[model samples]
Target: MIPIHENLKGKVAVITGGSGVLCSQMAIELARQGANIAILNRDAKKGRDVIERIQTSGGTGISVKADVLDKSSMEKAREEILETFGQVDFLINGAGGNHPDAVTNTETYQDEATGKSFFHLDENGFSKVFATNFTGSFISSQVFGKDLLQAKAPSILNISSMSAYVPMTKVPAYSAAKSSINNFTMWMAVHFAETGLRVNAIAPGFFLTTQNRNLLVNDDGSYTVRSNKIINGTPMKRFGKPEDLLGTMLWLLDASYSGFVTGITVPVDGGFMAYSGV
Candidate 1:
């Protein structure tokens, strides 16, 4: 194992949606780096399970069952964090997901007469996706960032998606939400500048996450056509591993290295945004 950094050791980090697939890996690595983790998740069992791994490894962690979309829930989680850890130093806005209704079967044109056009996409589903990704982050930031404004080397890292950079067919709500996250990252950075807090975001590329498992691969483990297309377009020729994001996570959270860096959506993508399918 590599040596952990001195500054990150014993710092408090709050990660929303910490029980999810990709975010769980990030939470573990942050604990391994010697941070006291406060995990906010709707699933209590999963949250405790993630925390137990860190505890087994001699790391400090406390799992809080809370919904990021609910402001009161997040505020209560913040209180719990303060009771246990005294203060929060870093915040990870990791709660977000897409919906089936917010997607289409193809990227091209659509019919409107039968109400199946892009204009006729399920309004409920689209709103749910938007609330989950964008509204959740905003509420979480409000709760967790309260201490960050006063803590030493404070930083806020929001999670965005590859669809944020450009149009990825089928996921209108997801793309819109992530794009808002990118914009909010910049907005929050300036909003917190006077308090010495740094706000940034991680725009991740395609990976086999729990939410996209059905779309990317089959139950038998064969790659789907969409998966093949993504791989071909990526310059790295492979999907990113969850560990691939740890370096950027650490950099953005650690003030000594990325103190002056703020309001930037650092994409941990394998040239997905750069490739034009030429």
Candidate 2:
């Protein structure tokens, strides 16, 4: 079990995309701290599995099937959670991922001899990524921000990426979307300052998730060329694990620790953002 925060006990944390690798771990960690977890995701079984794990560990939680892009669906989820958990004290916007069609095959325009150039990238793919990462957070915030405004020391934690700080190769859509998240996080922090709502983000580096496993790892558990490049670029010379994000997460969620902090995007990137290639 992860470490618990005494302040987080009995708080309600609504994690969008909580069934996925990283966020599921976040949900569990928060649950271990005695928070009531409400998971919103498209996959019912996977979300229920997370809830089951929480229950088995003597934690309280529920899974609500909802799409972050649809405000109505998120509203329904909010109502369900409010009915079940009383109120939402924390909002973790974790629903976002990159699409293959939005990815380019070449790092630069000059290296696009294979016809998978940026010019050939699908517009729909770009829109999907932007909407999923940026707009989804906006709407979820709108839906949950109500309870958050009234709850004790409410906070919003956006799941950003290293791509937001510096665009990663071949994933322009994702980079742009996350960049917008950083901007929006600051905007919301100021917009809700009077309401005592703390808005911030966690910019995670490359962690091997199902979505990017094929892109980063080979069949034999060896790193792909791209993965090796990432490792070399990281000052730590290794990839991050889901647990790497927990300390920062717990810090940001506990008002006693981060009461005066807001509108910042903390990097959990294994020094990838600090390295300048010497």
Candidate 3:
């Protein structure tokens, strides 16, 4: 069972990309803590499915159709959330993914490579991936800043990645974007230091989610080459589970647990960050 944080009770949390594998788990846990959850996703139906899960668990929630890349859409989502929950106490910037065109087929550049390589990566695709991960967080934070500041102890938790610390192979755009997120998290935390609005981030290690399953797993359900590398590099010898992030998440969101913690990215990587191949 997910541990309940009493301080989170009655709080209102707005989670972008709530329908995603990781964020959906976050939404459910937050709701279980008695927070009113507002799930924002481009697909309203998918968002509603998460809400249904929350409701089934006897938690309060609503799903809103919102595009993280669009300010007007986020503003509309905010309005809907306010109408239903009255205020926003937490904002989880969780909408981020890489485009296939932005990823290189090979880990390094090759002079005679036939497949998509670093030199052949589409500029538009790179821009889209960067904007979706970094710009989306910026836009959502700005839209919800005022409401968050009004709350007694507001917090903004961003989803970062291991790639932010060490650039991963074959996904230059994704690594760059997540690196930007780490810097942005520190900047925002300092910017809001005096406002009682703490900002932090959780940098998850390799997790086999729908978005990354193809890269990590083969068609027959065997680990891919890249997946083997990740596991071998990690001291735990495995990928992280969705539930692995909840403790750090709850600690960061509940002021009582992390009131003074800000401008930091906690890695729940099962010792991946600490391990070094001998």
**TM of each candidate vs. truth:** 0.95, 0.97, 0.99
Worst 10 residues of 3 by lDDT: 1-10
* Candidate lDDT values, in order: 0.89, 0.93, 0.95
Query: Which digits, one per residue and each the tens of the lDDT, describe model 2 over residues 121-177?
Result: 999999999999999999999999989998999999999999999998999999999
Q: Cα deviation of 134 in candidate 2 (Å)? A: 0.8
Better of 1 and 2 by TM-score: 2
For model 2, the run of ten residues with the poorest summed lDDT: 108-117
Candidate 3 per-residue lDDT, tens place, 1-278, comes to 86678999999999999999999999999999999999999999999999999999899999999999999999999999999989999999999998898999988888998899888899999999999999999999999999999999999999999999999999898999999999999999999999999999999999989889989999999999999999999998889999899989999999998999999999999899898788
Superposed Cα deviation of residue 180, candidate 3 (Å):
0.5
lDDT of 1 by residue, 57-128 (tens): 899999998998889988988999999999899989999998888887766665533334586589999999
Best to worst by TM-score, what's the order? 3, 2, 1
Which runs of model 3 end up more than 4 angstroms from their true locations? none
Error of 3 at 67 (Å): 0.5
